[model samples]
Target: MGDGIVVGLGPVEVEAYIDFACPFCRQFELMAGPTLDRLLEDQLITFVRHPMDFLDAVSTTGYSTRAAAAAAAASDAGMFHEYARTLFANQPPEGGPGLTDGQLVQLGQEIGITGEQFPETVRRGTYLPWPPFVTQRAIGRGIGGTPSVFVDGVAIPARPGPILTAVQAAIDGAV
Candidate 1:
């Protein structure tokens, strides 16, 4: 699987940015899930999923990256979202328990990516390198930690309420 980030929102276009593997990213997944779902249903925000694994070095992302690659391979098999859900659901605890490559193939199979090719994909580390400038941009935006959200290159502050408000504002501004 190749590495390409999907960036876009709304029925037409809104704002999109590179995302890394941070706990905050998962939090955003939870926090924004509802609004994002509504947007998807209404075709108000057409989210573009970009696969970026900034946490590659971080132990937390090791499993995610492998699983993401597996999902990517599964995408080639026409089951991207299914593999994604399975991977996220089974993400191992950072700095603690984790899934091995064998486990990843298992997940792929569970998500309907069943094949001998699945494990090979996971082993090859097929995903592309993380995007450049994302960390620098985040840091330049005063982000020292992860899960930083931005719109049109403007940093969205890191707070559930503030972040949500900022995201909404960004979407509104774009519209």
Candidate 2:
């Protein structure tokens, strides 16, 4: 759970604990991703995503775990941002079979995660244990749900506007 999949090299830290199978997490991503991207580009904040499998029981096929594991593999391939965006954009509903391993591989490929490494990692469940470990750590830290956001170690409401305001405040305070 230390540092998760980090992006950017800014002084401020923005951490998000998300579950792939959670609809609210998808909404948070869709609503706040662009703003976060802008912040990253501007080097205002270092975004750290903690992909978890907290919603695995909600998915009949354990989509949460599978998706999170795939995301970990994508992170290893240095394609985490693209793969995460793609996952949220094409998120599967809860209580149903999520994308199969092959479909996951295809999605990774569609996002330009080239080569057999990603696919083999996905199919082999190479990072399968990671999501659950993250989820447990999150729970241990009293994080009760998906889309939990933190700015400089303080929790913030997981909304686009609030998150933006908080990030801006952190930036202002840092300066």
TM values, all candidates: 0.61, 0.95
Instruction: Kindly report which residue pairs in candidate 1 clash with one another.
Output: 6-50, 10-45, 10-46
lDDT, candidate 1, equals 0.53
| TM-score of model number 1 | 0.61
lDDT of 1 by residue, 1-175 (tens): 2223332345333232323245555666666556555555665544444444456566644554555566566666766645655665665655543577777778778766766676676677664233333334444546555554554445555344654465566557752
Model 1 worst lDDT window (10 residues):
11-20
Clashes of each: 3, 0
- Model 2 residue runs over 4 Å out of place are 1-3
